[model samples]
Target: MSDEKVKIDVPEVPSVLPPAEQKKWVETYKAAFEEAQNDDPGDVVKQRQSALREANRLLRVEKITSADQAKALPKWKLVQCEEKDGVLKVVTIDGKKYSFGVGRGAKQQAPAGQGGGQNGAGQQGGGASTPPPAA
Candidate 1:
């Protein structure tokens, strides 16, 4: 129990991106901001409308062809796979809890609570015998 003060040294965290790349990115953002500020309001509105239409079109056309495609797609994590339904669902990791189905190929899978051994042996009434005597 002393009144002495201790100073702990903490190292600075290294940047994920190289300094040159970080500077380039900052400049790019700044230039984009300035350009947006100087652009005509009508032009901005038209650009936004075109972007919205393109996004809607892509969403309407998007489909998952395979499990690998679904896993490679951004912003979603596969939570469960059900072969009987020919559908697999994924939830978005970005706090949205958004779920979407991906088509699965025809494959037989064990039915729920049947033979998967998910339930304990005790619950299934499989007899558990006590060990005779310690050696």
Candidate 2:
């Protein structure tokens, strides 16, 4: 018998974003997708506003996080937060960056559940994924 057991080094899977965030991401991305399809910035902006309003509204509706906290402006939660031209450069939990006009990331989701993609599969692709990047 082999004295040493086989050491299975399982590859870590990525984490998925939260449902609330996923909902917001889907809404915004879908709107932008439609806008991109139409090639209308006006429509894009309009839909973008709509999405933002809805996102904020959802956050407000849920009351999970404060709608008015100095550091909690309730913008999209990103992998990284950047600032430019008084706008926020938020990288979606999936690493996609977008320009949010102004506000802190109102993401109340635990870091683990902040960026799950389609079908709630999350970044891990399933339950067998690795941890997400460090905050």
Estimated TM-score per prediction? 0.25, 0.22
Write model 1 residue lDDT over 1-135, tens digit each, in one string.
343322222122124334654455444444443344344333544434343333233222134444455457543133343322443443322221222233442331111233334331122334353443588
List of clashing residue pairs for candidate 1: none
Q: Model 2 off-target regions past 4 Å?
A: 1-11, 15-77, 103-135
Cα lDDT listed for each candidate: 0.35, 0.40
Ten contiguous residues minimizing lDDT sum, candidate 2: 5-14
Lowest-scoring 10 consecutive residues by lDDT in candidate 1? 5-14
lDDT of 2 by residue, 1-135 (tens): 333322222222222445666656556555544544344333444544544444444333122222223125344343555544444444444343333334444332222234443222123455545677699
Error of 2 at 122 (Å): 32
Give the Cα-based TM-score of candidate 2 against the true structure. Answer: 0.22
Error of 2 at 104 (Å): 15
